[model samples]
Target: MPKVVLVGERELRDLVPLDRAALDAVRGAFLALASGRVIMPPILSMAMPEVHGEVDVKTAFVPGLDGFAVKISPGFFDNPARGLPSVNGLMVVLSATTGLVEAVFLDNGWLTDVRTAAAGAVAADALARPDARIATVFGAGTQARLQMQALALVRDLDEIRVWARDSVKAAACAADIEAATGVRTRAVGEPRAAVSGADIVVTTTPSSAPILFAGWLAPGQHVTAMGSDADTKCELDPAILARADRLVVDSLAQSRRLGELRAGVAAGAIAADAAVDELGSVLAGTAPGRPGPDAVTVCDLTGTGAQDTAIAALARARADAAGAGLATDL
Candidate 1:
């Protein structure tokens, strides 16, 4: 019989302890994200006026590991009226050799948020300047909040400026981030102001059009764009590629086909080989990052399956140590 461990969000809250271990795991996993080691298919979603939702199914297999895990995150984005989050989901672990169902983690997307945030931190730690203080974050959603928290773990932040399409929403998001991270967070009136003078910038919006312009950034800045995980979504202008001294992506192939690089190449703003490096190469010490104090770098992260595998492994280990998971015979 295959044993299935069921873990809920509350249980996951206990499983995730904010620390460097989380960052390391995600970074290491991502460094090896390419070469078919992990499998993260695209998210399937649908939107109607009455109902809007998406399912992100991710799986990762590390060679020599006992098992691999898959996370099937399905959530409805229309629950704001009910005072609930627009994002929610769970993870499932499975046996590698037997392909049997091993565990089911019902975290309601908390673990996913943490893992994704950790990924952002990893990207910043590798590509951003050591003394980075100011950070500009786009979007006032859950990702914006988590990205801030994750970045705090990597850099010594002084102030954070946030921008959303709506001023009220931007202010509200900034306030929430300030209260949570205790950093000097403020809302910006424009997207450019949000990035101006900032050593590091993060874009987390879901916009299909460009939310940031190339002319707004200065040298010696690092940018982590998290909005364009799909082909239909883009948050930065293709011309921005010309401003970046280094363009590092989580996956080169995926970015070429669907990320900001795709649009940049399509628009003739950047060449296909213009990307000086990828994040994995930097992490592996094969490539340099932020070449100089005045070098501008961009880290494009389109969610990876390796991240899901790493987090699922951690969750399973924690559950086993605490004896918190139920072993169901299936």
Candidate 2:
């Protein structure tokens, strides 16, 4: 018999702690990804006027791990019009031994948000400069807030600047983060201003055009672009990519199809052999990171299935440890 567990967003919030353990899981998954132990297909999605969404699948048979997960996330754009967020979804966890579902976590996308942010943190821990301090974030959405939080785990941030088209939203997010982290958080007027002097700059926008230009980056800076998870979306100037001393991605295949690399390739700014390294390779010590203090590094993260699998496993473990979920025999 298989047991299914349903955990709502609030319960899940209490169950899973996005701390070092969660990040270690995600990092292990990425190492597996580089070693070809994980199966991650290209994400697929469809959109209508009222509803728009994407379905991403990741299955990892991590040597000592028990379960794998398939997450179906959908976004109804009209929900925000009704005073709700545009995205909602759940995850299905399966036993690795029997391939039978062990649990279904109706986490309502909160777990996904945390895990993804932690992935950025993992990338930063491995690729971002050791002295990274000044930070810039380009979105005021939930993910943007989490990005700031996650980066703090890896970098001793000194100053933080936020930018959003909506001045009010950016101001509110800045104030909230400043109060929470005690970092000098302020809302800036331009994207350029947010990025200038920043040792690490993160872009979380949904823009088709470049939000970050090469002219804004200084030597030894690290840029993490988390916005281009779709074929039509890009958040970095191809010119900036050309200037990068090292270009790394979470997945080579995913980066080609949907990450900032896709945009750089289209613009004739990056060649097929242009990638300096993959984060997994760097983490696994197969490649070097931070070759020099003057090197410019860029990490393109098109969220991977490995991350989903890692987080799902963490969520299930937390649920079991806390005895927090309803197990329905099916």
Candidate 3:
């Protein structure tokens, strides 16, 4: 009987700290994805409009890797009213050679949260100006806080401006991040007020409509939107991508299907055949990023299977070294 492991969220959290190591792992996943050898299919998404919820299934197999991860993520938009988290799910890591389950990550969604944030860090490092400092974030959710911590790794961020529909939630989020990052975190009522003059802007809202407009952007600014991972979700105005000097996506296909790019393509603000570069291309040096100091760049992240597998592998290895998880025979 082969051995199977169950790694729960407690151990996983102790292993992955949303640090540089995790960022590099996600970076490797992007590079491997850009190699064109990975077998990543379109995300499988099902919407529960009646309940204001959604579930997405994503996975990828990178050649030469020992295993792959399949993630089942569910987002119940109305869960908060019931005093439950809006997002929660798990990942199943399987052996590449035998296609047998090696481990089950009962992370409940922490793995997804960190990997998504790590992707944001990778995009920011590759696209944001080298000297970027101030950052403005839209949304006061988990990703909103994690994204800021991740971006701090690549940029010398000393100030963080946050905007959310709920002013009180925004204020509390700002206070927490301010203490955690030692960065001046301020909660603003207006979205534009949060974005104006910012070097890096990150949108982490699950808003269905545009909360961020292109007119609020300035030259030399870079934006990474990680909120819109479903067809019904959009945080930035579609026209925002049209004005950017470059449009990069974690996966152009995924973006067109669900990410912020979908809104633009659907609205006719961007051509279907418009040249779009994947974030992996830039990370691999096959394409240019941050064209100039004043160039505007936008990266649409729709979460990838490659990332899920990579982070799962990293967390598993670390947990193994730390003697974590429950071992079982199957």
Candidate 4:
């Protein structure tokens, strides 16, 4: 008899906290992708330009894992106008031994959020300066808050700066961050001002135009750009890649095809095959991270299927240990 477990959003959230366990799982996933024979296919993206939305399907299999995750993620930018959440999704966990459905997680993109935040931690751990004291987040949104927490795990962040187009939102984000992290936070007025003099910067906006520039970056700065996951999206100026002493991407192929690297290369700002480092390689110690305290580093993360599969497996384990999900036959 085949069996399947249905894990709902609340249960997954309760089971998985945005803490060290999640970060370790994501970090391990990166290392596996670097060393293991993990098979990950290209992301299948379907765009709805008229509706201003897109859906992407991602899946991957790690050789030794007992199961894998296939996920469907959708984003509708205009949903807020209709009083709806912009992002929603689900994941399917399948057993590797029998190729049977093991569990279905109605996470609504929560797992994606956690994994992506964890990737930021991995990047900061690899590239950010050891004495890093402050971080600047380029958008006041869900990711903006998460990035602050994730970065703190790796760096000694003492303060945070929040920037958004709307001043009210920016202030609110800063206040919330201060309350949650017990770290001093400020609402900066300008994008360039937010970038200046900060040890670390994280761009989390879903912008079609550039909001960060090379000129704003000082020596010894590290920037993590996680927003540009689609061809039409860009957050950093193309020239920023040229200013970096080290450029690491979550995946070379994905970044070249869809992320900020596409914008940089298409504009002739960076080489098409520039000795781009992969985050996984850096994590696995096959490649070097930031060379010194004065080196400028950039990490572009275009969320990977390996992350989804890893997080799904983690969620399944947690739910099973807690006896939380509803189980049924397939």
Backbone clash count for every predicted candidate, in the order shown? 0, 0, 0, 0
Deviation (Å) of 260 in candidate 4 = 1.1
Which digits, one per residue and each the tens of the lDDT, describe model 4 over residues 104-151? Answer: 999989999999999998899888998999899988998898888877
lDDT of 1 at 110: 79
As for candidate 4, its clashing pairs are: none
What's model 3's lDDT at 213? Answer: 95
lDDT of 2: 0.83
Indicate the residue-level lDDT of 224 in model 2. Answer: 89
What would the per-residue lDDT of candidate 2 be over residues 241-309, giving only the tens digit for each residue?
889888889888888888888889999998966745677888998878777888888899988877888
Q: lDDT score, residue 195, model 1? A: 85
TM-score of each: 0.91, 0.95, 0.97, 0.97
Clashes of 2: 0
Better of 2 and 4 by TM-score: 4
In candidate 2, position 221 carries an lDDT of: 87
- Each prediction's Cα lDDT score? 0.81, 0.83, 0.91, 0.90
Q: Which residue segments of model 2 deviate by more than 4 Å?
A: 49-61
